[model samples]
Target: MAITIALAGNPNSGKSTLFNSLTGSNQYVGNWPGVTVEQKTGKYKKDKEVHFTDLPGIYSLSPYTLEEVVSRDYLVNERPDVIIDVVDATNIERNLFLATQLLELGIPVVIALNMMDVVRKNNDFIDIKKLEKDLGCKIVEISALKNENIDKLIETAKSVAGQKKMTYQEFEEDVEKYIKEIEEFSVIKDNPAKRWLAVKLFEQDEKIMKEFPLYGKETRRLEEIIEEAEEKYDDDGEGIITDGRYNFVSNVTKDTVKKGRKGMTTSDKIDRIVTNRFLSIPIFVGVITLVYIIAINFVGGPVTDWVNDVFFTEIIGENFRGFLENAGTSEFLTSLLVDGIIAGVGAVLGFLPVIAVLFLFIAILEDIGYMSRIAFILDRVFRKFGLSGKSFIPILMGTGCSVPAIMGTRTIESDNDRRMTIMTASFMPCGAKLDVIAMFAAFLGGSWWYAPIWYFGGIMAVVVSGIILKKTKYFSGDPAPFVMELPEYHMPSARNIFKATWFRCKAFIVKAGTVILLATVAVFLLKSISLDGHFVDFNADPEDSILAGFGKIIAPIFAPLGFGDWMASVATILGLVAKEIVVGTYGVLAGIGEVGAEDSSMVALVASKFSVASAFAFVFFNQLTVPCFAATGAIKEEMGSNKWFGLAIGYQLLFSYTVAFMIYQFGRVIEGGSFNLMTGLAVVVLFIYGYLLFRKDRSKLENKNFSNKENDEVVKYESN
Candidate 1:
């Protein structure tokens, strides 16, 4: 018989590593029904008959967050035969809070003591036999990242699959008396989960109460039991039960966990320096700046040059054109094949080196667990602006791509914060926008700090937007409480890093091959054919074509931003299809067929058609505008309402345009140019922006800081 086992854990507990080791390439990923949160399931690599479900990482079975609800529902409703709960061995006291709840489901449970290597490294020891006996579960010590004893862990889980076990830990005697009364008299009779359900009732869990609501005399009795417990314990029902669970876990840990070196672990020492209040921000800035320098200007520069110069312009364009001419191909066909497809797609693909290198550094930071500290450090800054520290996760993720970043907002518990995050995340320059930044930097002979400046600029935009919106009725709430666990520093797993890089790079390559290729063909055809439908050389005349006429029609809308040239307008319009297509469009227009930031033809195109201020404005417009087609779809799905999606898109467009306008007019004045009507308008816009930014909070909700409900001292290891 096939054994169904659910793998569950707290975030950063090595659950994901263990799942990948067990399932390998046999897994399938999708959303849980009716929700956008990802669900992963697979059959065991060693034995296909043994099925495994990787449940969402959550701290407890409480229905407070979507992840917790999804996990709790699946365990209670689906009733998986057995569970492998991955617990961080170094913080077992906190992780056991989840273990206590999982034990009540009447399913066999196996505790996978992850990161045991770290425990051993510290000269600490755990009494597994005693721990197992107390928790009523089997225990296995394994390092998931190293694939140590993984087979043994699976074997033990399967061996106990169908057997039933109940949690042995009990609350205080008086609390247990009321819980038993509910189980025996009011809650489900003859149910295996009756003990768990009765406890849920006693605690007055909102979701559970709604699911199995009582009426008449039952309601009064339920209220009596809860009020009596609250009066006796001097706490709410949830708090009382929470304290009971913590007491139990504390006792168990004292008996099973043995201390060795107690001064401070290596991670604690590193955090003292890296997370120091005075030095943290500067250190982060230095780390990020150094990372981009190595990726963009040093290592990635040479390879990008080769891809743009020798590979695309010399080899593909030259060879293809020569072959087409020899075969007596028509000019239209030759131009379409060489200049249209090869030129445009190659221009975008040349930046793959820069993108892949940057993603590698990000992957390393995430795998080594430093990314969590970033949230903690930035929380103090973000909270004052009415934005949650959780906002940084999506904003940082947006530096890679906005699609996944928007989806990541699901972790935020508040609707207003999630909506605000989805709207502003596009301000971050994504992998595609990096091409725009690189192109413009080379166009203007910008310094090594150019690319990094755009990243920090994006963060500033999010902060400024948060401040403005906090004074409005729609987005005025105190920042959500930020709580995260800092995992111990360790060597990054090579396999994990490689997988992250490959997946992200593959998406970029695929889009260039498909979306940009087709869009470039259309752009070339429209520019090559005249309004009268006659074939003309777009490189020779350019103004007589349909695309030119269309660009001229809409060019005035961006005239204030200074890039009023037809080709610049054409490039910005095509950017809506995909941000990288803007580069491809410029390449196709220049008739160079392959463009890079360092290419003389692209630099000449900008110098002839744009001033320095106009070029900066053009780059800023593309950097912060409404994202490409795919990301807009993600925004729509995340918002889950057409009204909100429209509002988000409208807001993004207005924000991008106003910022670009201000930059150009102010820059023109800075460059000793004549002031005009547009300059006066820019000043007015600046005044309005400053007023909104400095306005007082107008939130309808109470001003009190509402953090996570759990006591941080007790559940210190739980992370989103």
Candidate 2:
């Protein structure tokens, strides 16, 4: 039989580092069943039979969040052979809170005191033998990051698992007396942790109270006992139990742990500036700007140019065209192969280097713990717009992919905030959309600053949309309080950063081979066939193609946005399949066959088709529009209502269209162009948008019926 051990701990307690060290390369990651929370399991590096399940990093086994519920259910139902509770030795007090809860689950536990290097470096010491004696569990000190004493920790955990003996710790006298009484009177015989269940009963854990079988009179008597205890302690029953556990932890730590000087640690000194009130946002902006500048222009630009000019255009396209001509290939077939397929797919793939560099920079930021500080600094600003800083996490994740970002809203507790976040998260440009942005920036003179401009534009889209939606009745509500622990800032591990960047870039590459490939093929075929009769010849104008006919039907709708041409309309429509297809379709329609070393024809073709203002409008429209079908499905699943999903899609389309329209029409007006009907419509739309932006929130209106009530009466009514 496989020996199973579960790893549980508070968030940022080095639990992940320990799991990575123990499991090495033998790990599988997926979501917990029926929840979006991540679950990880792996086999020990040395012994394949020794399986380790890394439970979600949770502070306690309370059923408040999905992660907590999943962790609690797994521990109670699966009942691993041994529980390895990894605790951060530097922050032992807070970590011990979870350790104490894990010990109460009636399973043999081995405590892995992680980050001992940090502790030792700070001149702190923990008496391992004394801690083991006091906590009734085997203890091992190990630096998971440094791979120190890992073998001993694993051996000790396996031995404890083999013993299969439960470890119990005594609580306060009053709490212990009530727990024993409840256990004796309880009829839950199958539960191994009867005392723990009784303690949960006293703490008024709603899930336990609902699931555990107890007589009606016994339930009433249990509540009475809890109330009497609360009265005696001058605190709620849950608070009393929490205090008792802390008291026990204090006794253990006071005897076994030695503290070092703590005026200001390195992390604190850094946080003082990074998390400062006035400097935080500007610093964040500078960091993001620097990342984009380096990725798009400085490092990634030359590599992308080579892929496009040398690899795809000169080498692949020219050689294939030469071979086709030598083999007497049909003119139509040659056009389909070179002008249609390779051009379209290659246009998107040429930017793969840029995407990889961008993902690498973002991964480094995340690994260094600066991303969390971005959330911490933005919380106050988010609250003013009726959103919690927690919403920023999903928005940040959206930069990679909107599907996961939409699902990430599960962490936000408020329904209105979560739904609003789901609706707006896709406004951030995802990896697929980056191809379109890169192409547009290249068309607009290859300026590096366009990258940050579009990025900041996406963020502003999210923020402005958040503020607007909050005033509407469907989304109007106070956001939940933001509370999150800031992990200590440290140098990012190169291995972890590379792994993350590789995985993200690999996903993009896979999509390029699969979804983007299919979309490009379809676009090529559509543009190759002629509406006049049959397929078009090699030199035939693409305007007569079947795609142009369809594009003409939808072209009028985008006339106000200035890209009313058939090709631009067609590309915009195909973008719904995949955003990268927008650029791919342009490459196909431009028909710059057999691009040479200095291939400026395609860029010139795009420049001729769109002015700078219209190009910006086109990019903005695609960036802010409803995301691809996969993200829509996620929105539907997360919103749990087709009505809300439809509303979200409608909102995205309307907002993007309105913004794009204003950019083009008003831009033309500023250039001393003629004032047309479309320009007048843009003025009207702007006025309505401004009205909505400044509109009073109907939800905040006072009601006479409620306001007329006396304060004491209102208080009494609410209490009852």
Per-candidate TM equals: 0.93, 0.93
Alpha carbon lDDT at 183, candidate 1: 80
Query: Native-vs-model 2 lDDT?
Result: 0.84
lDDT of each: 0.86, 0.84
Q: Candidate 1 residues 327-410, lDDT tens each? A: 999878998998888888877887888999988998999899888888888886678666788888888899789998888888
TM-score, structure 2 vs. true: 0.93
C-alpha RMSD of each candidate structure in angstroms = 5.8, 2.8
Candidate 2 local Cα displacement, residue 606, angstroms: 1.5
Q: Which one wins on lDDT?
A: 1
lDDT of 1: 0.86
